[model samples]
Target: MPLKYLTADQSRAARGLLNWSRVRLAARSNLGEATISDFENGHRIPSPRKLAAMRQAFERAGVVFTAGGPTLSNRSAGEGGVIGTQ
Candidate 1:
């Protein structure tokens, strides 16, 4: 599973919307700190669970996870390395 899409800005905005520090977000999402850090720094893609937690966190903050933002399905496709394969 390779990541297919993640504009740097979108990743950053997601972090902001979650209102979580990198460490805190990682802990809350039950992901490794390095993993979350990598995603924030555009060094690595997040797993489906991590992506879902991020979306949920954003939703809690009143941020709508819509087409304009990163989406669970998009992340899933990207992670599965099957973007456009359907």
Candidate 2:
């Protein structure tokens, strides 16, 4: 099955919840920082592999994405996780 990619908002939220930077996520996912930055900035959509890599990276770090928003596992990740990474 095709994996559901996280929205730009959710991606940003997950990063905040993990207190991670774009470089951090890119390093962890073995993807380029530009890829993550572009996706999160709504400049581009990542391929399945890149999306899966990013999601897996966040998941391993205890982030969970929901219809409502992204949250840290077993903890409340506050709303308005929107940050200006543009």
Highest-lDDT candidate:
2
lDDT of each structure?
0.52, 0.71
Candidate 2 lDDT over 1-86, as tens digits, reads 23356556667777887788999999999999999999988899988888888887877776655544333344454432322222
Give the range where candidate 1 is weakest over 10 consecutive residues by summed lDDT: 77-86
Q: Name the 10 consecutive residues with the lowest summed lDDT in model 2.
A: 77-86
Q: What local lDDT score does residue 6 receive in model 2, on the 0 to 100 scale?
A: 59
What TM-score quantifies how close candidate 1 is to the native fold? 0.52
Q: After superposition, how far is residue 77 of candidate 1 from its true place, in Å?
A: 35
Off by over 4 Å in 1: 1-8, 68-86
Which prediction has the highest TM-score against the true structure? 2
